[model samples]
Target chain A: MEKTIGNKTVNVSEDGYLIDLNEWDKDVATAIAQEEGITLADDHWKVIEYLQNQHKNDVPLTIRSVGKSGVVDIKGFYALFPEGPLKKASRISGIPKPVSCI
Target chain B: MTKNIVILGAGTAGTMMSNHLRRALDKDWKITIIDQRTEHHYQPGYLFVPFGVYGPEDIVKPIEKFIPDGVNLKLGAIDKIYPEKDKVVMVSGEEFDYDILIVATGTDIAPEETEGMMGPHWQKDVFDFYTLEGSSALAKKFRDWEGGKLVINIVEMPIKCPVAPLEFAFLANAFFEQKGMRDKVDIVFATPMSGAFTKPKATEKLDYLLNEKNIEIVPDFNVMAVDGEAKTIMDYGGKEVSYDVLVTVPTNKGSDLMERSRIGDELNYIPTDRATLQTKVKENIFAIGDATNIPASKAGSVAHFEGEVLLENVLNYIQGKDLKEGFDGHANCFIETGHGKALLIDFNYTHEPVSGTFPFPGVGPLNLLKESRMNHMGKMAFKWIYWNMLITGRHLPFVTTKMQEAGKNFD
Candidate 1:
């Protein structure tokens, strides 16, 4: 199923991948860890929120650099969001457009 | 048979020229663009990427997406340009012949041009926001960064978007504040210029902001080298400053094709007439944007305005008529100061950035020299305009090709 949140349209699938809103979900967050080949802890979410709020108005959020928020271990986060915060989240959130993920 | 118009480099200038000419020219002329990369990057987004404001995925799209139909997209590195024979050689062992050529080959960061800039600490401790990789790496560094002396240094002038370093400093202050490390971080602005910006009035206002943000400014400091192990940067005058992390804007150079073609100046920039953008070496060739050694800020707005003027001249050249010398180094940039506030500056070759309103003389929702939330929004809004209208060579409603002096205060 696809849902429109704000101006962004997200895709939700059965495997727990939210295509567009992956930045906001914990499962996509964990998937981000596996791609970057790292582990995410509960503390990493704080960094994610900080990054999301910091650039929310200017750009979209993704999985690529979600782990690099400075609050989390960057190498570890790199392991999680290897491709980036936006990409990982986009894959998990099932959002059609990446801009809404921000 | 259709005439071939070859454009070098698929960056902002080349892309704009391709779109503009595609619309203006008839089907008689086949416009072909050559670039090695497949993706078109929103170069301005590089600054925001480091602060986690723009993600890597958001700023990039396939080059083919913006390129209009009927334009031949050549995805290969350009080996050399044989102006004498009117041919461009690609690294893939292919040669393209053109009746008219547009040299939109843009500039790139040459950190290695400096003595020790690209040393062991690059991206780890020393970084630049000019490239996607550098900016994203610095974003990670900015996070968990407990804060110390965050030195923002500019090695030389004539860099793309002259005010970007200052923007980085301003945003860094905001970024640290959001992270609750504002008090711990000592942000410093070091430049080769005498002031915060190139223009005097804008410089005064920006210098004031530097002070307000508690960021120190070191002016006229020509960097000699970077001692990354010692965490210090030495200037030509023997001055030294140590930093926990160094965000440096290294020297920018034109495409290597310029050097290979033996047409570029000392910095690999093409020597061109400032007004007509015609290459000094070749009468049929023209240069725009950072590729030319023009006395203008290497910015997208300059290229945008130049595209309009150059199109007219290119058509004139094709018709064997006198070319129009119409380009006035018009450049307008949105200086992001973070915290939902930014400033707009508009100037040309003759005029400096003055205090006034933009698009309108007296009535403007966007203010110049003075910081405002509207200007910041305007900055954010430009990304869409760039993608949709500008690259497509569509005419913008408010902006024009020439610089307007009506509403600006000269004094």
Candidate 2:
């Protein structure tokens, strides 16, 4: 299935993940974590929510501010989502309009 | 029939190659250059545009003005390269046959490749100095701006003129100091690399300069996305850095034609023999400048040196002789550290940047790995050399194609 994040359309495997209560459930989280190589934490959920909401609201995020926010370390975040959130989260969230991430 | 030589993308490498080859080839040999634009930019001047040191009028000139007479300059977008046939097809459906092809089609910024980089805040709070337009726009923004938090970020590696963002940060410090706004602004440098530079010695020097300038160094910070509304840059680690003004060095990639041709590596850079400058896909085709996937610094000096070696090989190829592997991957760059002082570094693939006397060993002139006023003057004087000599295929008096070991302190 595909969903829209920011201006991008991302594909989610039908068997992979499911969104639950503003957070990705265990199965979906595990799939996202394995796929993105990130250890998703509760604070990271806040980041995910913020990114998703920013996409929905058309707000943009800077990498510097993201690093300073202290939700996660810069290296850890890069390891989990090497391609960055707009690409990875959009795919996991099943967002449409993938080019919007650009 | 005269042999046809087609050069794609009339940038630094393309222009230099055309000038070099035109002098070597007889009148009977046809040399055609294909490019999309009529204006040729002195790319290094883009860094100064944001600081008002170089105006738009200074950087651009007509492509025809620089290209020699008798060489056909075709202004059009290249569609694809048919290496199997030794031809380049243009977007306008015109195909030109060539005996040999030179791919000098340099790189482009893919700000769009990064999420939210080209979004609402683009050119407003988030600016890139890599482009002529972006740099000029930033100058205006810098002029009227009361600084809060100015963050200089490099999104990825392999960007053109790797020291440019650092130069911008340094220049920004000088700019703010001149304007008496240095106390008002907090400058931070965020890079994807483990340190300030790719080389360890250069990194040590740059780290010291960063600390000296009070520019906080946040290394290994991989950019995730930009929250323009929130004014924050988030890393995957959930670390966020907030900025009042975001100066970003976006991701750079080779020409889209590489993607269309399906012959490039992961980043769309053509794989080539590092020493030969010959494309791995075809013997008749060669890659130069920022286009090749060579593990060397992508500076104008690298192209200038590569041009020398490649030209020799090209002539050898025409005579049906074995091409010599002469390119040493030599690159020399002037690092501007603000305050009317700069550092010079000369190195190749194997050697890290070292400190010693340059050109003349232990005698006089430019000092390597040390900031000096003379190096800064040399850096400033290079613009005249570039336009009058370098691009015209004239050999620089003090500079050579190969790196000399005599002047460097290896120990």
Top-TM-score structure, candidate number: 2
For model 1, how does the per-residue alpha-carbon lDDT over B166-284 read when each residue is reduced to its tens digit? 99999999988888879999988988777798777788899999999999999866676899899999875568999999999998888899889998866788888889888887888
What lDDT tens digits, residue by residue, belong to model 2 across residues B82-104? 88888888899999999989999
iRMS (Å) per candidate: 17.6, 11.0
Candidate 2: global Cα-lDDT?
0.81
| Sequence-dependent TM-score of model 2 | 0.81
Alpha-carbon shift of residue B200 in model 1 (angstroms): 1.2
lDDT of 1: 0.80
Which residues of candidate 1, in runs, are more than 4 Å off?
A1-102
DockQ for candidate 1: 0.01
